[model samples]
Target: MIFPKILRLDKAILATGIMAVLTASAVGTAEPQLPALPQAVSSFGATVCDGYLYVYGGHAGKTHSYDTRSVLGSFHRLKLSAPERWEELPGGPIAQGLNLVSHKGKVYRVGGMQPRNAPGEAADNHSLAEAARFDPVKRQWEELPPLPAGRSSHDVVVARDLLVVVGGWQLRGRSHMPLWHESTLVADLKEQPWKWQAIPQPFRRRALAAAAIGQKVYVVGGLSPDGPEPRLDILDLARRQWSRGPDLPGKERAAFAPAACVLNGQLIVATNEGVLYRLLPEGKEWEKVGQASRKRQVARLLPWDEHAVLLLGGAGGGQNHDSLEIIPIPPRPEPTPEAR
Candidate 1:
């Protein structure tokens, strides 16, 4: 199986000065600085619930490689106001690759991977379909109905009171080449008995970033069969159908799971190269905003409020980062009279 092509600076054209000016001008205002994480980690699941940030199941230490031993099951939490002080929570049953999402003040851990009971063994065969819901008030985890099939590196978002599991990868063979998935799953949170219902996907990919705006869910940047996916897809929960959106700017694959969130009625996406883009609700294209504080891959974006977002742990330059950066989303500047 062939891996997706990773984009490098030498292979792609750099951003023009005009684009830089547009981004820099948008971020001219001052914003509060964000604190770093308690420790460095990557491939972790994170979410915001009840004004607290929760992180779980990720890899730690520098292996320079993806190994099962590096997979961690630790759980941590901190108040968004004081992120520098973290509290250890009860660990989850599984290891890394799970996706976390919050609903009605509760946190849910979705499908992910775990290592088989062998020392230094590959975890390809250990993809999981199990899921659990955490009650922050009680500080307990309750088992929930599992998914129909095992998955890892998938995107999960809450839309219309349902949990939607998007595309991801499943290990195929000894080579562990990822078999990208196009199947979508939906779970009705308010149903009498919880169950997963299979749905159709517009495309197949894995390690993508997603955000929900109003009734629509926007999925962007992932590893497709050909390479890094260039198109953005939006799902209309009311219609239960997928529609195409604008393509991403530049040649960057947005690889290693870039971060995305909805801020002030606009969609904000941060690529692995630390570049940020803004998309209006009614706009046809994505506009470059500015660069984030750090260049990291596989990071998680947690919205603090309408004006700011917290970027969690990820890897960069062959090492996992323990830092957290605050990305401020200022209102779009008004067009000048000359331009108008």
Candidate 2:
């Protein structure tokens, strides 16, 4: 005698299927079908904090110089919901054309330079070391420990709450010197003191873009003292090792700030020439992502929520930006339970 048997779907399988369907529905309804291409905001040295965008310390094209430094100290912050109006913040401890990062609800401005002498003279080039922190809650500014060396075109990023400043060149006798301190400094907000740790240098280059993805920081594309064209480098945070990555897609240029961010589990790099590139995890190659609207130097890039990125102004050759650019971030895929 034979008995007819019926198989029912497992509870876990049913749950997964339900989850996948719900996720697909949510994604379909939540995201716009097609996002408009991002446009460059004319403002340079912009920082986003507490849902407000801040622009500080960058000069217009006419005021900037090729040989000397250009700096502005004005601060302008705008809200995303209300794009038209820009409210001015109290101007103190201003750093123009520098990299800004936020930690513990406070914003820190680092690097960039200013000319001591009058404009048009290429002789008086100086980098800035004055580090300033802005407390959004208190709406006040406090001076923090200065950098060991003053550098303008270097990259500063926060990883695991530690602020690591990587390679940047200093002006010396009408030429620049490639700098690699090999020291990764950690800022203790609670402790009120800075702790320094040594890490291996990647290319000993400067004026590069630094992006912290997971535990590692990838420093991509910079100009060496000898010339603008050079290879790329990636520094491992855990093992203190340096490995070579893909080269820049175009001619090497310094003080032309590149913006680096992690999108869809991959590292994305954008150059001044409006070139967008992506770096894969396993491979040591970089492929083009998209073209930027215009050329921008010293541009900063940071994550804006989970699905978008904010690009602030850097000088576009002789042109400085007050324009703002926003790009929708691509979502990453999740692994299955069995794969995990």
TM-score for all predictions? 0.83, 0.74
Model 1, 1-340: lDDT tens per residue? Answer: 2223223333333345444455456655444455567669887899988878889987675633445567777788888666567898887765666668999999999888675544455434456778889898889899999888778878888875889888887754455666667778888899857888876888888878888776677889887777888678888777888889888887756644778876665778888888888875455787877577778877888776655677879888889998887666667653211112
Off by over 4 Å in 1: 1-35, 61-64, 117-125, 172-178, 333-340
What lDDT is obtained when candidate 2 is compared to the true structure? 0.60
lDDT of 2 by residue, 1-340 (tens): 2222212667787787775566456445333232211222332355567777766665553634533334456666666655666777766532344667777677877766655655666546566777878887787878878877776667777766777777765543346653444454445455557755556564555656877765567777766655564366666666777777677677766324577876544677778787776664554666664556666766766555555566666666566565556555445454111112
Q: Number of backbone collisions per candidate, in order?
A: 0, 14
For model 1, give the 10-residue run with minimal summed lDDT: 1-10
User: At residue 141, what lDDT does model 1 achieve?
Assistant: 91
